[model samples]
Target: MHIAQDDIMQESYPTVLQLYKLALLVPQSTAVVERGFSAMNDMCTDLRSLGQQTLDSLMRINLYQEELLEEDLELVVDLFKNKKERDMPL
Candidate 1:
């Protein structure tokens, strides 16, 4: 007597399925935006001066690559070493 969700969606609830698809497509909510602002506040202290582009890049890395931030600095530095010829040590 149990019907699968896909079967139910296909059989008699096309409108519901369409609504569900639209809901999935909706953009992220305000919490993400608030988190971005919070990150900006934390990163932009008085001692450090950053250009707008640099600030944006740092904020993005802070917010999205949080887990990567927890990793070892040497491993992260190694990634940049291969990208270009460096005149000085990293």
Candidate 2:
């Protein structure tokens, strides 16, 4: 049997194409996601739920911890220390 290149090219292999696309989307490992979850679990508890923004910020700080040094920490502390407190209205 002889087949032309055009015939092969024109064939609609939707299933194969879709499977290939999905394969590309699959992660090689779930370790990173699992690690993040583990960190979150350690940081939070059943009795205390953090706000979404606070959780996200804490996650980022935890993730990039290796990049932060003692000086960086002190600077962060200093900034918060110097920040003005907002007055509460009755």
By TM-score, who's the top model here?
1
Alpha-carbon RMSD to native, per candidate: 5.5, 9.6
What are the TM-scores, per candidate, against the unseen true structure? Answer: 0.53, 0.46
Candidate 1 per-residue lDDT, tens place, 17-80, comes to 7787787788777898898888888888898878899998998788768576667677878878
5-85 per-residue lDDT for model 2 (tens digits): 244533766566556668879999999899999999987889979999999999998888878765498898888799898
Q: Clashing pairs in model 1? A: none
CA RMSD (A), model 1: 5.5
Off by over 4 Å in 2: 1-26, 70-90
Best by lDDT, which number?
2
- Model 1 C-alpha lDDT versus the unseen true structure: 0.77
Backbone clashes in candidate 2 total: 0
Candidate 1's TM-score reads 0.53
